[model samples]
Target: MKRWWIGTTAALMLIAAGCAGGTDAKSGTNRHDRHTSGQAMPAFVEQSTIPHVREAYAFAEANADQLQYIPCYCGCGSLGHESVKSCFIAGKKANGQLEYNVHGSGCEICVNVVMDAKKGIEAGKTLQEVRQQIEQKYGPQLSPTNTPAPPEGK
Candidate 1:
């Protein structure tokens, strides 16, 4: 009976650790934050788990004005993602504070686009120049109405 009890306790501890790992340490904010329209936004995953996601989020937050005009070719538009920035920022509050969207942490395309934009901006490229480069590379492969046909069936 003592052995069984110890095993059960260990299992419980493992489960608890898994649950705790999902929370964001920096914000410590609950996932049910209200949107401008008073709707509940989805919970965001912790960005620390993914390489470059945190940096991408930071760039998106810092350059929102320029990124707002840059289009995303990841087909997230159906999710109301107007631009690459929208994948990281859900909306702004009345006081101009940003409500971060956790979606970018899970999206490779979003992270790549943000990183590319950051590089371009650092190299002194104008917003229009960055937009042109991104569109030229990703526009043709956009998932919306442009995904390539699958290769012959396995």
Candidate 2:
């Protein structure tokens, strides 16, 4: 009877320890908490249209501050995208690590914008210069509309 009691007590203690191991003592939250920096990571799309989308995402995360000043001409501003940076990053962690947004993977335009910014940075262009070049190329076309009306009548 004494041996049985001791074994049961040890089993109970092991179970308690296992449960305790999964929680943070200070925060009282799960130890595997996904929150990094201050933002919760956004769910990335399962598939990307471009093969190089992952590289574009990393580039955007690494150069977010610079990309933030560059605007996107794809009309994504309606989706709350203020700058090219918004195409990739949702927010930053306290340690400065980026929480990425999934928008870039699905939108070729966003990915292209990031790629262009990366190229500009690699070419030693200042942010202002890059912004100017992008604006000149993609800003309002020569005419208000680049495409003519479909046809006089179908």
- TM for every model, in the order presented, reads 0.61, 0.59
- Tens-digit lDDT track for model 2 on 23-63? 65565655433333423223453356576676677677667
Candidate 2 stretches greater than 4 Å from native = 1-46, 93-97, 141-154
Error of 1 at 20 (Å): 25
lDDT of each: 0.70, 0.67
Tens digits of per-residue lDDT, candidate 1, 1-154, equal 9999999999999998866645444566443333343333344534245677767776777787778777777788888787888888888779767778877878888888888888988999877787778777787877432222222330
Let me know the TM-score candidate 1 reaches against the reference structure: 0.61
Among all windows of ten consecutive residues in candidate 1, which has the lowest summed lDDT?
145-154
Pairs with backbone N, CA or C atoms under 3 Å apart (clashes), candidate 2: 37-93, 37-94, 38-93
Off-target runs (Cα >4 Å) in candidate 1 are 1-48, 94-97, 143-154
